[model samples]
Target: MAESTLGGGAQAASTSLKNPRTAAAVRLGLAWLIVGALVALAFSLHETPNRGAAASFSLLIGVALGVTFQRGRFCFFCIFRDFIENRDSSGLFAVLSALAVGGIGYAIVFGAFMPNPSGRGLPANAHIGPVSWVLVAGGLAFGVGMALSGACISGHLYRLGEGYTRAPLALFGSLVGFGVGFLTWHTLYVEAISVAPLAWLPKTLGYGGSLALHLALLSLIAALLLRHLPELPAQAGGKLTWRRIYQAVFVTRWNPLVTGALVGLIGTFAYLRVSPLGVTSQLSSLTRTALNNAGWLGDRLVGLDGFAGCAARVVDTITNNGILIGGLVAGSLAMALFTNRFQLSRLTVRGALTALLGGALMGWGAMVSLGCTVGTLLSGISAFALSGWLFGAAVFAGVWLGIKLRLHA
Candidate 1:
């Protein structure tokens, strides 16, 4: 939580970017070109190994996203931090802007064209899936835990991408927590999610009505956030200010809205290529595999599919598994290289343990609730699910309580 850590990284990354050194720029340009070429080639190779192409594409995307995320230091936890501790709204603006862009895009794609990935019937949109008591409880727990852990699931990924040694500890704990969640999956589904009512904007209000409502709500939140930001002083590092706030929302330099939209578009295109956006499930799947290999889980989880429940398996496969999670790590690494600051972080035992505990809570809470903040909150909102809004509200409340308790401090 030291501003210096966030501050130093940015100055370092920026200074490197602005460096007049020809050799460094050449290196960066080459890397970007290589990544781009690979993407093109991968898409063109209709006859090549399809699965490998998907994985490779995913890995490449991850690399790029990681670098951007690490260098940009964009994160949900920080957004909330600015709001709770600093009363700044820049971070929130980034989120809203991204959602705004994404919403407009999705409205065009799903609302009108109704083209499926293959130009088939429109893919089943999940603005909000079934909502239940479990969602509220689980989301609240995950949000509070994120504050304590200093990051949410996605936040942890970006930190790890930046070479934060503590992040892997949190990730490992998340794996264990996922395992525990799987063990309890039966009770959770039978008593909670299975019985939950599926919420959708299409049913209550037409798609047009739903989209308008969402846009207005998010816009209102953004306006309220704007009002709170002026109270904060601009810090050289991570502090929020009106200028930075404007930059976050309006500046094309690195708008969160644009970033999130690109991610959404990529996710949508990824659905074209392989799947929709998803992150935690793949990790959970990977964890399930590891646990099964270790004889910890039996056949119950082996080859089990959440696809039936999620209904966007292809998007989930590509977005969650390949892009978001991998993109984070890749984004950070790419950024570090540009900055010439690629080094593993060192951390105290206490810090490591704290991350681990926090990760466990996040992983478990996410599973019990059926998604993380990004998956459940952001994506769900774009889909215009009432549950998504509720989950987001719960997250804010939890963050507030955590800040009040000074858990982050």
Candidate 2:
């Protein structure tokens, strides 16, 4: 009787596996399991001597970032494309929201860290870069690359987890571009970057003035963008339940403001704890290390190491950025799977070529500029660096050109 009952249970399990609903349930279960494992790994890393708590925190933050990026559709290129192509400025507001929130948070943190804003010394590890034509050129290249590749560097990283087949090619192209940047670093540095002025808003305007100006600028942008935004659909009113909550949190794309605010909070915490929110340091480091090892790159990259957006360096083990990236991918993958959004697509030759070309341009631009959108633009602007505004403007112009040329096609 016991054997017969066991046989019946096994048969039922097999039948459930064959059912589509059951299979989906199984997939969700697996995703949850993986997420659990990631959390456990973070804890374990905290206890480990080599990795330490910082690595653990970075991993967790990365996971949060990945989830946010995926849910919010926080790709800068996507945001710009939507506005340029569809005249939908909703996403732009998200970007503004993030910047505003981050700026305010940064201001408080800056005050605590440095009592006097009008000082000769800059805040430690802020994204303040020298304002120069070199920066403009880099930003333009980065923007064009985004259009060609169909995503920014951070976008590609998160999208990679969603089974974006072109991500690998784009990323590889970036590595090559980084290599090229390393080759040309000395000349650019000596010619322009060395003499360029580092413009920090607080250096001249003081914290209060800087924050006011930042908020005012964002508000103006927001007001201008209002004309482009489509009328939002009226939300259906209903009793809130666990299922509704689940759908709102996991199934639907998040509201832009909510998404931006969360992103702002994450960036703030990231800066307060580990470092500023940049994604390219590890990629650059890897590229630099590879080139140096191959004897193609010199030991010193001129004044490259001095300015701090996302400083790349040679390293034996995975750095905090690396860990963050890992968590980002993993988190995105889990979310994708849970949402039934993970699907592998076939890559055509034309698609592959464009991705590679675009990636290369982006890589070169990021290398030259010392960061990409997240680093130089978002983080830099949050820190009130004029270079951030310059880079952002150039990137916008580049994207516009790319769109006009139909490069994304």
Candidate 3:
């Protein structure tokens, strides 16, 4: 009787596996096969990417990063929360580890690829040109707003794609922040931006030394990760194993470091193709154009003339305008459908308004500081830019304070 029951159970399991509705695994397997073919096709193309193609490559990298980040549930805010609230270091380790790798990679690339590493590096935009006190203040404001909004600038974008009903409001607030940024740009140019201290890695220590330092830092972060891993209370039926650890490390998709590096590569390509690693300028330029068309302010800002002109070449795809924006939305939406996690949920009215306010602050911060968390902090840090570090420090402080104030609590 026992043997017969065991056989029946095996038969049921087999039947379930053969069900037509069980399409996910089949689809995933087919995707891998197609990916293999596409990779082969790319290799067959047999042409080294020029600067222009490299820039396009960067866009593709950004797309990959977006997909990875979405699937991994990786975010700076979550990283900090993991440490502060949950006593978990995995998320933070992921960020710092990625930073270390990306930082070293940037140093090597810049040191080797650039005509003059001491000056601006290969892509003129990659330079950590200078630092200003205003950056510290701006960073602080942005951090505070991010906490209150319950999302950062990039956070809102990704979350928006995840069906966060409040994300749009947050983004709208960010636009207003950009407007505020425009209002303050003139003062910033004179009082803050021009005199900000220029940061150069080679000047402080030679390229090789800096790269070594970055690698060492990465090792230290990994060590910290080992020591500080959180002990999550197991779910009622959960069993821990190598597979579970693997799932935790990689989640359902790509790693954050790879995504970030790909983003950096895309930045590298962007430098070769059109402009720098920036999103605000293009958006700001668009804002300027719209306002001008409405008989609003023009000839007032540095970026306005270009948007007003809408010159096809520069105004088109140069900045973070097109690819990052579109790819993030697309990646998130696609992942949602794939994972069966799509849902539209609204926050409290207060929370919704807070998101908007926070978003506005982020936009303003990005505008005044010349970029947002991704552009200014992540990309900037990887490039060894002083502004990036300062911005990071400031943002962290602000988040701490915001939490203390219970803004998002």
* The best candidate in terms of lDDT: 2
Q: Output the better candidate (1/3) by TM-score.
A: 1
List model 3 lDDT by residue over 91-165, tens digit each: 766567556756766765665567465553334556353478877888888888888787776666667767878
Better of 1 and 2 by TM-score: 2
Q: Could you tell me how far off, in angstroms, the CA of residue 372 lies in candidate 2 after the best superposition?
A: 0.5
lDDT of 3: 0.61
Per-residue lDDT tens digits for candidate 1, residues 1-409, read: 1112322333343446433344355546754664575456445543355455676566555555465455445577788888888787767876786566656655666654453333432345343455877678767777777877888887788777556787788888877777777777667777767767766665556667767887898888877777775544443687788877755532323645556556556544543444444458677766666766778777564222432222212122343364446555656655554454555777877777778877887777777666777677766776666677778887778778877888776
TM-score to native of every candidate shown = 0.76, 0.94, 0.74
Q: Considering summed lDDT, which 10 consecutive residues are worst modelled in model 3?
A: 305-314
Residues 321-353 of candidate 2 have per-residue lDDT tens digits of 999999988898888878777767679898899
Task: Give the Å shift of residue 43 in candidate 3.
Answer: 16
- Per-model lDDT: 0.63, 0.89, 0.61
lDDT of 1 at 77: 79
| Superior candidate under TM-score, 2 versus 3 | 2
